[model samples]
Every structure is written in structure tokens, then in C-alpha cells.
Target: MMLPARGGPEPCGGNHGSGRDHSPARAMREPTAMTASPQPPSPQPPPSANPAATPARAAPPIRIAIIGTGTIAHTQHVPVIRAHAGFELVAGVNPTPVPWWAEATGGLKLFSSMDSLIRSGMSVDAVAICTPPATHYALAAQGLAAGWHVMLEKPPTPILSQAMDLHRLACAAGRTLMTSWHAACAPAIDPARQILASGGVRGMRVTWRENVRKWHPGADWFWKPGGHGVFDAGINALSIACAVMGEPLFVTGATLDIPAGAATPCTAQVRWATPSLPDGMEGIFDWTHRGIEVWDIAWTLGNGRRLLLSQGGGGLSLDGVAVTLRGTHEYECVYSRFERLVHDGASDIDYRPVALVEDILSAGQRRPADPSFRILP
Candidate 1:
């Protein structure tokens, strides 16, 4: 059984000035599994899979238009596309000129907007929307309506209703829509899921903290109303949590610590429950830290078996012994999956993460900002 949204359908209060309705809809239940936690040594997948062994495809390489040439697009999306055999980087859409790195790597046509790209007659089979969360729904809707497959960044949209709308739009347009959860595609995640599928879960503890200054730097949108504050990072953890424990019953309780001048929370503590585990199968989601960074999820099973995934799903341990797994290439995996989905005409739009966020927004309580926490810039 899945937990229901505590606060009926209502937008979680924040500084969402984008004019889009941020109201959440009813919670959607997903498949079940145990939560994540630390555990002892266990079996692991090979260091890496042979790319040659990937299912052979006779279709031509997918021509892709990359929207938003920001940090993530530059660091992960572009590089992966350049290396993948199944995709072609046909065009790039951004208001600013293409970045030096992107320009340096030749073979990309640039456009000022998605409209210009489409108007330019660029033959794009799919588009990867890497823009801010607030713009996702519009951009994705446009892409799907234009009959192009879409891969949206995490937290699919600002609100649960928008995400559902996109799913429905994609269905109507017969286009594939995938919401990318990079962390859940980590190498260690498969093994962790396998363990949970084989046993009963006791509880889970998630510690996902990072320095915004170090990662986001002067990205002001991060502190805006729809920016999702700490949730920008916290949602990744929540994605993995839901992947392991299934759809959350509801966000039992939460506390958001907003910075003085920021429109979003800088730190958050959230408790969620799922029906798959016992009443005591508690899960904690925390995102408030400075200096060193940490991303870990540990699960305790009913039989006392412990499992842990650290380094944001880059490392895995079972029964206290490290389990060496494949090198981390989450973006590459994402593209590979997209290739298959497009060829097979399938859509994988998981709304559990959006539902979880909506549940938190609807039911979680807001606390005063931490006096010491200051928003830079």
C-alpha cells in the first residue's frame, strides 16, 4: 500500500513566481522495494559491461537537439552524446552563444531558441531538456507536440500535475518521454535494488548534503521560488529512495530552513513512510551541510542484513565489505536507455519523485531560516 498525500491537492508554499501552477495532485503509488541503508559485503556486477555487447541496433543514430547548455549539459550530457554511437549531436539551443568547450568540440549547429532550431529545419529526432525546472513543462510540451522524443532533467516539472500532463501529452503525440534521475542510474543502484527485492526491509537512512557555493556557485535561480532550494539536490536522493522503497505513503513530517533573502529552503529534514515496510520502517531525507560533501543511503533489513550505497551510488558495500562495481557513467547509461526506448517506441516517465516532492510540499511544515546560513550573491 502507498501512503496518501497528507494535505489534499495544494501547491507547496514557496516563491514560485514563474506563473505556473505549482499545485500538486494526488499521490501516485509505484512498485515496492525495501529502503536503502548500510550493509555487509555482497555480490557485485562486473567492473563494466562491454559496449560491443550492448544489443545491436540497425536503426540510424538518433539526431538530438540539446536544450540548455549549462553546467550539467556541458559536463555530462554533451560529452556522453559525443561518445555514444546511438546518438548524433545535431543542434544546440541556448540564448547565449555556444560555450567555448561546446564550440571547440566541432560539429554542432547552434540556435537561439527551440523555435529557431525547429524553424531552421534541423532534423532532430529527440531533444534533451536541460533547462531550469520552471521551464521544463513548456519546453517538453513543445518538444512532444513537435513529435520529438524528450528526456527531461529530474523533478520533471515544478508540480505533479504538470508532470502528469506531460505524460499524457507524450502519449497523445506518440513520443517517448523520459525523466532522467541520474543518481538512480548509478552503477551501485542495481545491486542495491537486487538485495532489497530478495529480503524484508527494516528502515532507511539517507544523508545527502553538499555545498551550494561549491556546486552551484552564483546560480541565483537556485534560491528562487520554484528553484526548489535544497530540494534541487534533495530530490536526487528522494528519487533513489523511492526507487528502492517504492512509492512513499506520504511525507510524515518535514522542516525547511530557508535563508534570509532566499525564496527557497537552504536546508531540509523530511521523514517519509511506505506501506511495504513495517510501521517502524522509517526513512529520513536530509540536505543541509557545508565544507565536505556526503551522499549516502543505508538500509537495514529485517534479518539484520545491511546494505549501503555511498558516493552518490558510485560505491557499494554489503556486510561491511566494499563491493567493487562498474565505473560510474550514469549519463551514458541514460543515453543508452533512451536509445532503446526511442527505437522501441516506449515511454518511461516515473512520477513517483514528483509525487514525493508534492507530498512534502503539501504536508511538510516550514521553519524559520537558519540565522547563520547566508545566501551568497
Candidate 2:
């Protein structure tokens, strides 16, 4: 499959030139004390003799505990949390010894388990669960029950029922429970959404192919039943697509390519329908390409305008011209929104993407894995 061209230079990070304009606008000239002869100053109300009131103190940053110091926790979650002013990384929970980088970056107070972390009397207002998909439910549920706001990494749980249960737990505890669909917050997503909303979509296609060995390396969990195989990363594309063209109403058909002796599919082809799209509009997700990585989604509008979002939303082109989007700092954006969700006492848990994954798993036809294909060590 041909990947859509990214069309321009790589999106840069950091808010280098961005800063609030704090300088006051030019002061308006004091109106010339013209005619009106300042009517005899109306008697001014007498000032209270009590001491002046003090300003309210600012709330302290939300202390966050990082659960599972794995690849994502190290690469994205931890750095973003450390840089964001609204949050503080106070501790880390993982069975493995705390990674060197985690220790170097202020030596997070480490614990082998969630129970131990909670029992340690460490102050934490929220928890960022970065563990594998199968473990998300248990950890998130425990956090919510312990009165901590929870931010779960993508594919919130292995199945839809568990995700819904977490939502209920969060609601009962009156805490924020957010499923971080990082791709949904990409730079180009909002623009694509607006384009689709205004100009009806005729069709949509997604190509989310990448070499598992390159990205996941020796991760054995990926071949397990709940590991989600290709959909593990493909779901990011699905989430972005859903954000652009409303949620898929149903999975029309699907095919799973599972390796021999493996419980999960290494590659999957899924077709889904959405009322927002025209009748017979087919959306394709292909995750088996080997050479170059392709992470893109394209849409055909009713008026023949072709829109493409590629590089997992780092680049966008509408009818061939590069569409300028805000800087691409998806993880940063995720944490920023998470902070607001925590303060507002509201939850933003959307199960549409995961529900779609579950649908495919339940209905897709399974094929034997290629005999020559070797599982990455």
C-alpha cells in the first residue's frame, strides 16, 4: 500500500516563540476633564475599618503516581508529566527495578505494587496507568476505589465491559477517569473533524501498518489473547478516524491473521459503518505492511475534496496543499486536558474506539499465521 505523502517539514516541538502577552495594551488617554464640572462628588461610601482580605491561595499541583515504568511510561508519560506544571510525578509502581532513567530523573519513590504504594502513605492525587492493556482494569479500579483520579493509557482495558465498569467506578467515587487516546488529540485531528463536519464525507481509508519488531521488540505480551496484536497500535488510527468521522456504528466484516500457536492476530483487516458517512462508505484498516511504516487516514468529501492526515497526525494535506496545524505535542496535550479534567471533577471516558476493537475480535474470521513468519524475540 502506498502511504500518503507527509507533504512538508517535520512538525517541531516545544513552545519556543509562544508566550502570553502580559504587557498591558497602550493605556487610553485620560479623558480631558471636560465640561460637566464634576458634579459635587457624591458622598463616597465609608470604607470598612476591618483588615483587608487576603487573596485565595493557589491549589498545589496534582501529585501523580506513574504505574508501570515500561516503554510508554518512560518515553511519553513521565516526560510529559514532569514538564507539565499542573502535575507532579511523586512515585512509580512496577515489579521491575526502577529503570535507570526513572531514577536519574529525580529518583521516583518506587514500589513493587499498587497496594504497597498506597500503604506507604505517599501522597498522590492521581494515577497514570501505563501498563499493558490486560492490566489496565485492575490497576485503574484500584486507584479509583482508593480515591485517586485515574488516567489510563490507550485501549483502556482488554474488553468493553471492563471499560464500562471503570467508568461506573469513577462515577461512584466522584473522581476523574480518562482514557488517553493520544492520537485523538493530534494537531490535525480538530481540523479534520471540522472539515468532515462541514463537508460530508463520502468515504474513509486508514493504513496503520508498521513492523512490530521495530517498535515492540521482544514484547511477548503482544502475542497473547488480550494483547490486541495489530489493533494495539492500529486502534490509535481508529481513534483518530472516529474523532474525524463520527464513531463507527458497527463492524461490517473483519479478518484476523494470527500466527501459528499465537492467541492474538498479528494483522487484521476490519470494515466498519457509520451513519455519519454515506451509505456503502467503507473504512479499511490494514496493519501488515513490512518495509516502510504507514500511519495515515484519508477522506473523500462529497464535493471531491481529498483530505489526508498522515504521520499519525503530524502532517496534514487538504486537496494536496499542506494544511497548517498547531504544533504536534500529543502527549503534552493529553496531560493538559487531564489536568483540567481532574480540577473540574468530571470524567471523559469514551469507549467507542475500544468497543470497535472488541467488535472486531468477536466477529472477525481467524486465519492461520504464515508458516515462514517468525515471531520477534
Candidate 3:
């Protein structure tokens, strides 16, 4: 799940800023599987100025505009664009330009608004909407209609109807529209997907718990009706869920615990039924269990086989074997894939993932647990 207001380097919903999971070692892993059908072992990149900047492919990178120069924009998205050749770091938009340090991506023009950028002759080939979930629609629709390809950050938007409309418009315009499920782009997940596809799962149980107060601090926006707090991370699990299950799962039940006076759920316990697999398979997701947060996703197969995948969308500990990836690049990998699409046409929005989240939002309209979420001292 793409956590909201994750601005930069803040421990988001107990993710510890994802800084720990992605180590220098991650920078040393093998190339993604999609690059070559079955290439022979090749030399890896030695530590250089910026290994992450290495492009999956090289060319005149797409002139891309990153709308909303917020936290993730400066931290991950911009770096990915700069590191690769599939995209060019042409311009960015925000109330203010990214600071001098942010110029690492280089040759960036900061605009005050989308209209300003489009009118400035920046000639953007694509636009990555880095704005908050609530504002995604207005800006995305603007980009797509303007004839530039668009890549939207996760939770593509707070509204499903608007997202669906964006999808329609994208189709109508025949422009590449993508929603980056950053977790799904992890180069480390290839093995996990192999196991699931090999019929290793019979029944899977998933759990994600964390300490929000300490992590979020004064981020009061999370408790608002559309802030999408815990699910911000929870959706990462869902994307994995959709990847394994590979279809839209219907939400069977859910209990959202909201702060008493707040409009959004601080914690959520949800149940979803996956499409029939080898056996009748099902799963559960919990967004607010407190402490270091737990992401326990296990699969129980028939014939007495069981596999538990844990440690948050990172790796898989199959039956008992944990594959330690040399690298754990998420957004870098995502931007790599986007670069691929820009060079060769491709689309990567996981609707089934969003569909389930929408069901959860629609299913719960209850009172928040402590309402005092807003009155915090």
C-alpha cells in the first residue's frame, strides 16, 4: 500500500520509512527478469555515483512532468526518473520549486500549477501525478486530456467513480495511463510470485499491524474521511493479494475502528474471498494491530503443504526457505517499468487491487473509535 503524506523519510504507518528494507545490498542485486528472456549470468553494477540511476534502457528519455513536488516526489520518484534514461526529468510543479539539493535530477523547471507547466512549452511526453489521493482525479484527467501520458501514484485517487472515469478517458485517448503499485514493482518479488503461481497456496492468512501515533505525529490528515491511513500500507498487502489471487476478490466482511470524533478508520479488520483456486482459498487483512506492525501472509495448500510469507511485501519464506534478495528496489523498479512503457507501449494499473479497497470503503461507514484523533495534544 502506498502510504499517504509519506512526504519524505518519515516512519509511515510503522513502515520505518521503508529505509531499512532497502539497503545498499539492494543496490547490488541482479537486473529485473523482464529485461531478457533467459539471459546468462552477467556482471552487476559496482557501487557508482548512483546505481539506481542506471536505466533499464537508454534513449532520449521521455520529457516527463512530475506534478505535486511533495515528499515521495523528492525522495523516490524524481530520483528514479533521473537514474534512468527511459524518462527525462524535464519539469516539476508545486506551489514552490524543489530546493537546490533536489536539482540532482537536473534540468528541472518548477511550475506553480498544471496549467502553468503545460503552457510553458515544456513539451512533456508524460506526467506523474504525485499529488494527494483526493486531488489525483482533477490533475490526472487534465494530463490525459492534454494528450500526455500519465502515471498516477497509488490509491490513484480517493474516489472510485472518478478513477473509473479516468480509465475511460485514458482508453478513449489511447494514451498510456498507469497507476504505480510501487510494492508490486519490487525486483525481489519475482521468487514469491513463482511460488504462488506454482500452486503452493491452498489457504492464505494475512495480517499487517503498526503503531501509527508515534509514526504519524501531527499528521492529522490521516484521520479525515478520505485520508486512507492504515490502508495506505495495507494496500501493499492487497496488491500482493491480487497478484497471488490474480482477480478481484469480493469483500465478505469488515470492521473499521475509527476514532470517536473522526471520520476515517484508525484500524481495520477485513475479510475477502479470493476466486476459487486449487482449493477454496480465502484471506484476511488487518491494518491496525499496533507494535512494529505485522504483515503475516501465509498460504496453506492441500496435501499437507503450508507456506507463510511475511516481512511485508518484501520477501517470501516458503515452507521455510527465505530468499534474501541482493536488492530491494521498489520505486526505482517502478520507474524502470514506466520507462519501458514510454519506450514500448504498456499499462500497469491493478484494478482488482483498487476494487477491493473500494469495497472496504463502501462497506464501512461506522463511527471512528476515539474521535479524539483530531484533538490530540
Candidate 4:
């Protein structure tokens, strides 16, 4: 939504950005009580309506395929698709077996790769990309040009130009292209937005730090150039910031901590703008913390009743006031939204948030870590 244009990763094409594509094997395995579309899907909306949000349509299950079976896919994508009724889990192509959740599903088809799948002659309405950031551009572009709708994992592309290209393509194709940020659906976000929406004016503080070894032990994808390190965690905060303040928070001053011996930042202390926002914000983030570190949000309300959020916006307390959460239903909600988009023949692939991440990277200065980082057990 914000910048230049480009093509898919392999060669490039479509609205501007890279897309993923491939084909199918058997006929789409339609779930009971749903219509088999000749086409795709998107995320779902609430069963009931709020005056602020649009009423969502309950769609028949959408015909779908998945590319790149990685950790995120095993943990989220594959599992969510099978468990939810809004989709027809048609194809799974990863150069390997359907990891855990996908394996649980009885009889879905598999492909060697997107290119292989498409060449095989099976039909699919949409493709879900769960690959790392590095490959997103190409994979996504292929999918879009092939007339398939796309649903991407977070921080769609490393560069703004690529993200812009994808956004433009989706608009032109009149197909759905959603770069979903799963964390936004966290329970604390809704009420947090409500508090800000009520119109209180004030300044804020934010901190997000986690033990990298605990989260990414052997997987060293962090410092890999485009593999945006801390912001990987910070995107959740960014998603919340936009939901609360309404637009991209202008980055004022930032110094990212690259491990002295590595490339990406392990921590960052920065200043951000909330101009015209009734509530403003500032923050600090780190991934080198030793033990369980903090992931929190705080604000000074107009009345001075400071509101705070921890557990990454799950447990909230206002001036020491605590709010209990029920459960997280994000995956189900994601499929539900997909169902609505497909039934309505619409796509929601916006690059605003991804663009913002790109902007932060492009604008921010890089600073190396103190002692530098090395492997640990």
C-alpha cells in the first residue's frame, strides 16, 4: 500500500510484488455442508456485528493449498486449515511430509513444490505461504499471476518495493491477497483499542524482550539480512500500535543492536511518533535477555490511571487493575475470515503493515551488539 512495485521472487510479475503458485492432484476435498468453489479464501469475521466493523459472510469451505512447510506452518497454518471448516485442505507441497497437524488430516494431496504442483495439472483456488521472509517475494508473486488468491504469514516481504508490488497486483487481479499478522487477534488487543478509542490523550511506554535461545535455539534465521530480528517480535507490538493509534507510527530515532559478530539486531531502543493521536507511544525491545523477559505496554490516561498490558497484551491491569483473558481463537478466526473473502469473491492482501516494517528497517540506523553473540546450549 505504500511504495514501489516489483514481481514474484523467481522472475517477477503481477501487481508488482512476488507471489507463490503451483497446482493440485485430486479434486478439492470438499468439507460437508460447504460449497466447492471453482476458487479461493480469506480470514473470517465475527458471527455478530459491531457498528465499527462490517458484517461478515459465512462462506462455504474454500479450496486451498499450502507451500513451504516450516515451523510456523507446522504450528499454525497446517493445523488451522484442517481444524476449521471454512476450507478445503486440497494440497500440501513442501519437499517433505505434512509435518504434524497436516499429517493428522487423513487424505490431503502433496506436491514437491509450487512449480511442480502447478505443472502436475491439479486445480486449486488459493495458496497459503508459510515460508521464511527471504522466499516470500518470489513465491507470492507466482501464486498471484497464476490466478490463485494468497494468504501470507507475517511481515510479508523484507523490502517495501516488493510489498508494494504484491499489494498492487492483488488490487489489479481482483483476487484476495492477505498478509496476516496472527498476533493482532490476541485478546488484549480488542480492549486495548477500545481504551484508546474512548478518546484519552497521553504518552506511553513499551518494552518487548525475550530469551532468544529459548525461542530460536538452533534456528539461526534471525540475522539473515532480510530476516528482521527483533521486529519479528516487535511486529506484534506494531500491529497493536496501529490498531490503537490508527496509522503507522512515524519512526523518529532508532538504533538497532546487531550482534557485534553478526548482522541483525538483538535489541533496540527507539523513539516513535504518535502525532495527533489521543495517546502516544515510545519503546524498547531486545532478544538477548537471559531468562523470561518482559513483553508489555503501558499508558498514562488523561485521568492518570495508568493502564498496563503484559503477556504481550493478554493480561491487562489499569492502575493495578487486572483483566483476565478467556482463550485464544486466532487460528479458527483466520480460517473464518478466509471463508468470507472467498464466498464474496474479495481479497484483503494489504501491505501497509509489512510496508511499515520495511520503512523502519530502511530508515533506522544499525548499531552492533556489545560483546557480540555466539552459540550456546
139-160: candidate 3 lDDT, tens digit per residue? 9989988989899887787766
Candidate 2, 109-181: lDDT as tens digits: 7899999999998889999999988899999999998999999998888788798788768878889888787
What is the lDDT, from 0 to 100, of the residue 287 in candidate 1? 36
lDDT, candidate 2, at 263? 82
Error of 1 at 41 (Å): 25
Per-residue lDDT of model 1, residues 1-377, tens digit only: 23235744432222121111210100111112212221111112112324654557698999998898877777677777877778988888889876454563485777889999878876889999998888899999999988899999876887777987887788788888887776676667666766776866777777777777766777778778767787777777777665555325456777777778887777777776666643443334333466566778888876887888787776789878998664445666677778877898877777676676666766767777768778884
Task: Give stretches of model 4 more than 4 Å off.
Answer: 1-59, 96-102, 277-280, 324-328, 375-377
Q: State TM-scores per candidate.
A: 0.83, 0.82, 0.77, 0.79
Best by TM-score: 1
Which portions of model 1 show Cα errors greater than 4 Å?
1-50, 101-104, 246-249, 276-288
- 227, model 3: CA deviation in Å? 3.8
Give a tens-digit lDDT track for model 4, residues 190-286: 5666675574647778788777776655776667777778777777676656545433466776787777555667787767666565335678887
lDDT of 1: 0.69
- Lowest lDDT 10-mer window, candidate 3? 36-45
Give model 2's TM-score versus the native structure.
Answer: 0.82
